[model samples]
Target: MNLARRALLEAGKLLVVLWLVSVLVFLALRLTPGDPAVLLLGPQAGRPDAAETLAQLRIEMGLDQPWIVQYGIWLGAMLTGDFGESARSGVSVTTLIVDALPPTLWLIALAVVISVPVSILAGTWAAYRGRGWFPNMVRFTSTMGVAIPAVWLGLVLIIVFAVNLSWFPSGGYVAPTEDPVGFLRHMVLPVATLSVFLSGILTRFVFAEATDVFRQDYMRTALAMGLPTRRRVFAYAARNAVLPMITIVGVQIGALIGGAVLVEAVFGLGGLGQLLLSSVLNRDYLVVQSAVLLTTVAVLLIGYVADIVYRLVDPRIAR
Candidate 1:
């Protein structure tokens, strides 16, 4: 298909996926045990008029409405950029999300900046070395890196670098505008923790792709021609190998948003992940639903961009 047609089809798929996600996010919370109305009126639940008050609150909050009606109301509000109020804090859900989004974005951006080059270099080096000890070691390390949990890694780094060494703070976030140096220092460990896992996966992927590129007939011909090592690798192998890595990297970056949630919680960054967790625990239905839907939108957009990048890398994909 042509690019326009492909894009249209992708857009349709995006809408379908988003609709499904909206339905699931709505139903899942409603099906859960706790009533948001009851949760909100905590101390008042013991009052003599508790039942009467709860019933009145439910009506006001639209909790007394049928599931379909509630879903329709929410979906309509969301389409117009109104995410409603938090059931717990009575704050606007959109405002809550907007406030929390930046720290998470910074974490993901920094992690990508640190991890990508390291992964590319390590992976390319391993591929170039073939079956040598270095390649074997890279493979082993990458495997372990992927298997390690982000939360555990964050804690270990904190104990070593933050506590014993006193090199970086244990947990917290500082906006770069307020204190550039302090912000960098605060982020180092969390960024490092996130980078390690991201690099591990990317390294393995690049190694596999570059290895296949190295084995291609053209690469063998370049070898026979005694082409300069840099030219052969960069001009021939890398160009081809990097094409596939683009899509994987894009998807991983999208996933990194979700993955950063655990790291953010561990490090106390007050990012969307932490907000979402708190909202879920507090039964802040609007906040939780909006957070999840926002995350889903981010992931889908990243994937769509990756598809576009594929067409840019190799125009054949658009066909």
Candidate 2:
């Protein structure tokens, strides 16, 4: 019953937040300098009939409508699962997003799979090792990972693995349905770049939490109770330490989505991030608004899932 109520409350809150986000995205794009009509009409923008053409274009695009009315219309359409069409291409925003969503989801999933275990193991080892050369090395590498930009890391990976080694494709994507091997080859570098960044962030949190959990009185008692070394560490310390990581894992989805924008630009992948980037650059308001709103909702949904998982992991959260 409590879970059901909580879910209902969260759904309502999400709707309210999404409404506010749509309003902000709509207003921000409109308030930006340079008229979309002028850009769309380009060479003919300076013609004598330009003002009349612009007015007509605005009317066609519903830009001439008051902001509140425009928003109300958009909200109504969105509630019916319509996101309208791209200003430049006239392609449906929903269609564009549907086409591009797969790659970004794959990128994020692959990166998380590679990073999470490595981070947990490395963090656990460092916490257990206490004062050791290996821990120092891990810390140094994590520092570099956190400090390095994803784009720069991507370029370096491309140069080393794609250019020098000639092991993987430098840019461009192949759909897995067409060529699975080629898809994996193309994705390897981008996944590695994102994983390094995510691992760095997760490792630090895991290390801190594991270290603190290790020092708890229960851990000390376990150490003194003749428990097997692996059981004492993994079953007790590691488990408790990992609960904190669930929140970070959820938050990392948003970070990775943002990073995927630059990473996609670097790799030339036709992901949603790339679509969003191009839509924003071209001032495709319907596409931009839909993309940003969807991304925001995805991030929020991931966060809500994380909270639910945390509640499951730590019963105290339910109370």
- What global local distance difference test value does model 1 have? 0.89
Clash number for each model: 0, 0
Candidate 2 is scored at a TM of 0.95
After TM-score superposition, the amount by which residue 295's alpha carbon in candidate 1 deviates from its true location, in angstroms, is 1.2
Which ten residues in a row are the worst by lDDT in model 1? 233-242
lDDT of 2 by residue, 244-275 (tens): 78989998899999999999999999999999
TM-score of each model, paired residue for residue? 0.97, 0.95
Q: Residues 188-265, candidate 1: write the lDDT tens digits.
A: 998998888888999998899989989889889999999999888777776777787778878887668878889999
Task: Supply the global lDDT for candidate 2.
Answer: 0.90
Q: What residue pairs clash in candidate 1, if any at all?
A: none
Q: Give the Å error, residue 205, model 1.
A: 0.6
